[model samples]
Target: MLDYSVRTATTHTPEFLGLPQGAWVQEGGPQFAGQGVVVGLIDTGIDPTHPSFADDLSTDSYPVPAHYSGICEVTNDFPSGSCNRKLVGARHFAASAITRGVFNASQDLASPSDSDGHGTHTASIAAGNHGIPVVVAGHQFGNASGMAPRAHIAVYKALYKSFGGFAADVVAAIDQAAEDNVDIISLSITPNRRPPGLATFFNPIDMALLSAVKAGIFVVQAAGNTGPSPKSMSSYSPWIFTVGASAHDRVYNNYVVLGNNLTIQGVGLAPGTDGDSMYSLIAAPHALKNNTVSPTEMSLGECQDSSRLDADLIKGKILVCSYSIRFVLGLSSVKQALDTANNVSAAGVIFYLDPFVLGFQLNPTPMRMPGLIIPSSDDSKVFLTYYNDSLVRDETSGRIVRFDAVAKILGGLNPNYGNSAPKVMFYSARGPDPEDNSLSNADILKPNLIAPGSSIWGAWSSLGLDSAEFAGESFAMLSGTSMAAPHVAGLAALIKQKFPSFSPAAIASALSTTTTLSDRQGKPIMAQRTYSNPDSTQSPATAFDMGNGFVNATAALDPGIIFDCAQ
Candidate 1:
């Protein structure tokens, strides 16, 4: 379910999150506006005819066809076509099945379109158009502007539609990018699962990444959005730049309600008929029940419905939950619950936990509502309580009482802060180099830097656009290190534009030096703030979390100091 019509814009129009839309271009755009530096975006393919990029050059249809000179054979077997709305190119690769072992693995790449919208968004953020007016929420904002607005793109459809593919294809793509002499290689895809005992085998993709680095191509990868845990690191190879997510200055008010028995202390008293309250009890994501295989859609009505604690089900509700649902579902669930309460209803929803899901928060939207989203970890206890209750309930009771709950604001959660602004998101993965540590499998000296990754909006596929019923009027706002990695990649292109002789190591060093060790909120990240002792508050530094500091694009472009790999 990808939405293609939601075009990413370039102005800080406050419609979304008031992010620095044209910040990269404020000073007459990047130094490499059109120097013909080829940047290879290795992810899902791109939609060249996107209004923001329709006129820009694409490697897909360049009359002067480029070479894909790599150790792995390259071919243009993927077809290219343009619809009245978009220009799409397709490609495929094979995947290795873990359960069946390597010998049984087969080629799995299929015609690639962004069946999932992650790749398209990543590409746009790295090299989108410089000036095109984008309309969102009835306001006309500028176009799909990237850090390197004028760089030419060589898109590799390495990640398949279902996000199923082998790591070998990724390695092949990297080799091709290097042979093609791409200025920067942006990788937004990571392994979906860390196979048992697989790290013992030499990963061809890791080797390819190393090769690309040696060839002087700057590699930028997503740090992953799994959060404060030690097992959330996405990519830990020292050869590439890893990125994190941060909250924007803008606030999109949404709400969630607490369960009847579970009382959140800080929030104000129950609602009154006088009017809406303003304080927020907790600055967190509210939990929701989800079926592992089912997709959940949230609406305002749902949020209102969840607030009715008096409903019969509240007494025995079992909350089945998952974090995979879209942010919209969380917001709507909260709003619906509140409305139900206003009407003096008593139904409660129970949330049950499904394994391996991530939770999210709501950003400020133009239409204001009081809501909050809870992290999956925080809601697990509540869910387990009701789940256990259901298992032991007497046969006389009817279907397990299920009441959905969403949190709403009462006050206290302000959006303003000093340099510690909400720019750096807490959920961004951390790392300590798993390869060097037995608990994790990541390389110790990798993911040297961080970049801008949060609620990044971008282009959508024609197929995706048609499937989305709501949020259909404009661009999609997605958050992840995937979005942030490209910003750094584009910056690398700009550096190459200025200092053509600089090697990839120099570029990585420059970026790392220029970045702030702390996040936008001024919180010390990386090795600086890990729990290292056994004081109940301290733990070991695990490579699976906190790779490096956040990236400083402005500083990387003109670093005061640089690391010389030659030494």
Candidate 2:
């Protein structure tokens, strides 16, 4: 649910963690901004024509590496002109999606041009044209730059619009990336599940990535978003740079001020205060199911099933949806909720995070009425308090007290509610390596480390933006480990530039060994989705919270030296 609004431009990257300005760059150490390295993006394809991929500033250090065997696969939908110097290669894999009857050729683009903005945004994050102009809804956002502005980008279209493509498709994509002989692969693809009782190698994608790593390409994958929960990680391959997420000092906060004046702060790609709105709020106390389904199951008002709701009570009211237990009954996506709302003719819906599951997941579905996901921290307290207050209410009185909420999107032009950066994002999937490596005999700690992923601003495709909500801009902001992986991907490209002979293992070692443990507060770093004692608001993070810690590109640049294992 990559529900992010376009953000005013913000400059971040290896420099955000101290690249050229840091001591490493000061020492005249090689500050390689990925000069000759090529990054293979195996996600949805890329939009070559976006300002981010312009060849105006691309360096002519290498004319497509000698090992690159990949061709610019051309079709009617994707012409040969699409591949420029910046986007060195482009290809797509629809085998699995085609076989599954999920690939709707009519609706989804057949070429490498990303109809889904994710690929373009990610590609830009890795190696987009530096200093592209940005404007969102006519608002002037300053120029933006990629982490590795001078690096080359080759794209493999494995993931597709609406998340089409199966594991087999992903495997094929990896195989193609490997064949292309890319220097580094930044795979933002996340798996739906960890194969039960199977070694990581048993999974086709893992095997494929391992092969890519063996070929000397540094592989960076998104640590799953199911975070703070120890062992809920999915990208568990030991050989890959499984990257997790951390918040940058610049936070994208959405503030929801309830009718009771209880203002709660959550996260998303904020649209600034100008986008704020006020709405009537309604909440369902119990999520218990009726005779048809299990008990204690319900949605506050997420429109999971309009039938499950008291249509009379919910109509004309802002529905408050809560996740009790994945306690879903028929409602699958936010679209379904929109349909239900249209059916009921409701004003809007406010999604409150259940303290238990409490993700405040960034991906979102557009609403017929206004929709905002209330953060778990504040909403949980509100829910508990509201439930208690409702106990004394007399339903027979035929009068119900309602709560109104003010939704304020804060960032860019708005008063900045900044964050203490390098903190483990509440949603970054934690790890202790959820898999049993006994079979593969390669037990390794996971998420490798964290990077600035929360509400990251990057280039987006106008073709893709039409289908999405919130942003009518050329650039969009996204969050999650998906955004984090490319930060490392860009860094890996820089590392490759500095040491072209180093193996993937050596690059991973340098990154892991040089991580920082303390955060902006000078306190021990903490990961998301964790709670301890005292106030229980936040608990001490463990190795699983942040495998190594926040990534430091400056330190990683000159790790002194790295030793690769070989007989």
Candidate 3:
């Protein structure tokens, strides 16, 4: 999922970026399309009813694959018939947590239905149906399609809220995936910590992956998103195809125009502002009527209750809020500011990115009003300049400066960085080794491949209806390495469809060796820099950044010599 900041309508399909059907269709070559193959995903599970998972375009009935032994888990909320041919199998595992009295049945379902949206998104990316109209915040992002539209999906639920998944649960899911005899397994589960050794035989999850691989199932895992910091990759298992995330040629452009005639481009999921309108700008610190100093990032950034704002001064103006660099504000932060602005009937809100989190990382977020996230440590300067200039002057003053700020939608028609595809995502994990040098960085390179993972559009869970973009919708957008790993998995399924006799290692080799270092036009690809005093500098994406660079499915179909390795 490329962070969906709600901008632009891509003129191309998923295949245009060399996946789903782009490269192969353009080449007019093998029509694999992942037909008759299974893509097993171990995550939080999936929405059985998402159009992305339905073969008949509805949650009606479809025949299950003959080899699929996985069960369609039935709960009071989710029925058994939900697992159709597209979603051939579904299962849940939370035994350790339930036995340990740690699982909350009230919030966490004991069934296979996805309570969280992560699994559904990744699964859809791997092998969901194609030509599904993807609309986020009322803006259609063309038609959404997956890497392998015809691939069958087998879900293994293991993750829970807060602390991700218990190790036992994740490991058990992998074992079941093997038992179910799925062709490929996608593991984007966040590691509890960096593994102590190179070989994956020690950790329970890694051990499960090793067994799955030995059983001839291709495994794909995420290079954790704790990057810009080198040697911070969590998944280091050689057998598992660890994937890193990279930026594609899609950018969501949400911009802001100041009263001082300064038009600063930003990003967000602002769907309301139809056109530009003039308004006054009010700073959050200035709106503080009580003047109580905020100590926490949320309190300051969100303009929480304790910070009493002057409603009189705020009415009919755009609120500019600022916070420290320590934490990135969540959806709650966006809602809180909207609440404050709504009280005064303010036009909109602009969140000044206080250092730490880079600007381009601001994805489109659903908002009550036209809200834009400005990625700048000094955006406050713009507000202050406007405010001061707008102040009424005395008799001695020659000319008066006016602060008439304006906000525009800059919606999903033209993204700012539309052509800057394949840049390593800001948060995509980077690595030459899995851990720091003190713990001994392994000689083995991780993140075997990169794919369309950031701000990706996919199916969402209705039960998890907390987002404004997904109030009653079937599909939404998100970003993470979790979104990246399944892409390779889908490709693996296609390779299997073409070369059924090829081993998992052989499939992995085809995908890995057949990757491209340059973009479609042969431009050198740029990688995101994780470690620096100035953290935004993008370097050349190497094998550490992108395993073999972006996955090239068309070329991979005929890599004459299989590049087998010793793992």
Candidate 4:
């Protein structure tokens, strides 16, 4: 029962990688946007309907490469025409899960259709059709284009949202992908643990990838998410080009302004309340209409259940709630809290980070109404202190007499830049190369390179069963070395397209050797150590933190030297 878990793309990538988009020439060669290359994604299935996979992005008709012979699994969810010129192939492998009786068709799609959004997102990052508009929470972030916008996608969906895929299924998917003659295979998955001794490289998945490399197919894998720690690299095989996650220049920020004129920066993609005026704030427990209700009746501070709150008392006031472990477990969500707020006609909502939920990085959640999520527990403490000081409680029975706490959410959709970027992400797996189950180091330099993986915007499945907040959105912003792998995969496609004769090792060599080590401001690349003090605590990145530094797409086109690895 060897199970492999998921890893989890997109925009501002092409220019950042220095790859030219659409009709852009590549040093006396045809457009290097992966025109004739195919990228095989081995992860959760894909969404056939995402605009990023549409084949109509070009004036000329898209034609499937003659070398590709993959089939699209036609089911009720995934129809016959799901495979187009751009999305050339689609397939699913779940015999292991089915035999093990863990295959729940109700939640995990039997077809190639993506049940979890991970596959679609990674595919879109690798080689989704160009110029798809990204709109989430009614705000347009920007148009997203892949690194190799014209590269063909061949999907091998083996992973699922309900349960992760098994090694047998993953190996089968890899074998079939290599059999289909895909130019590149992108794997955003890793084993639950390292195998013992030589088994590390002898594992079925890595062995199949070895065969793929022997067949001239490039393989890119994520360097796991267990990072900022030594020997955390998951893909330790020397044949595969492993990628680590890093930050990019673009970032979105939101803040809350208290009635006392103190502003606290936070994370959320939400709007502000009416005008600049502050509204009365009340904690969920204090606003309960039924004072006799037991604490066990509902989550007192999470605001998950609408009936647990007093609609009349909540209306025209800013409701305060807690962000807890329930959010991580999917037992509670910002979307559910927003629903509770809207049902009660609350003016806005503020979520204070629970002290219990530590080391968890909060992404910018979309809010339908005015909302703010205070990610720092310290900041949450400050907020709670202000709220308590403004509270006027009844002296006799300890009831809230007056709800005097006040605050306002500010518009948070605007994009900001000028921060140093391409720093090795804190969660991006680091290396001294991982040890086998026997605790022996592989002696290989892992995370062959680093790429933009934080807060990446990419296509999402409408059936986003993975994230409750993004269930119906067309795009999602995700972070992981999973996203980083596809960035290199797409770039590999471009390099493959430019030099059709280049071996996988040669392509990997070009990318690794031509990387840039400076940020946008010409500063040396840095590595994030921890989330606690992400901004001020970073130090200069070492080779283990960022391998050959951030990938430079343009320079890779002509690395002048290519190291050959005998397959």
lDDT (Cα, tens digit) per residue for candidate 1, span 175-285: 767777777888876666454454622355556788878877777777665555554566766666776554444332222334344533221112211133222121011
Residue-level lDDT of model 2, residues 213-320, one tens digit each, is 887788999987777677767778778888888877754345555545566664433233333455444454322224222225454344566666556655555565
Show how many residue pairs clash in every candidate, following the order shown: 97, 9, 25, 3
Candidate 3 TM-score, true structure as reference: 0.84
In model 2, the number of clashes is: 9
Total clashes for model 3: 25
Worst 10 residues of 2 by lDDT: 1-10
- Give residue 408's lDDT in candidate 3 (0 to 100): 47
Query: How many angstroms is residue 265 displaced in model 4 relative to the true structure, after the best TM-score fit?
Result: 1.3
Which portions of model 3 miss their true places by more than 4 Å?
Answer: 1-13, 20-32, 57-63, 195-201, 271-277, 283-316, 322-331, 339-344, 354-360, 392-413, 435-442, 465-473, 531-536, 564-567
Ranking under TM-score, best-scoring first?
4, 3, 2, 1
RMSD of each: 10.4, 7.9, 6.1, 2.6
Error of 3 at 561 (Å): 2.1
TM-score of 2: 0.73
Error of 2 at 543 (Å): 2.0
lDDT of 3 by residue, 441-495 (tens): 4577766778767777777887653244454566766777877887778777777
Ten-residue segment with the worst summed lDDT in candidate 3? 1-10
State the local distance difference test value for candidate 1: 0.47
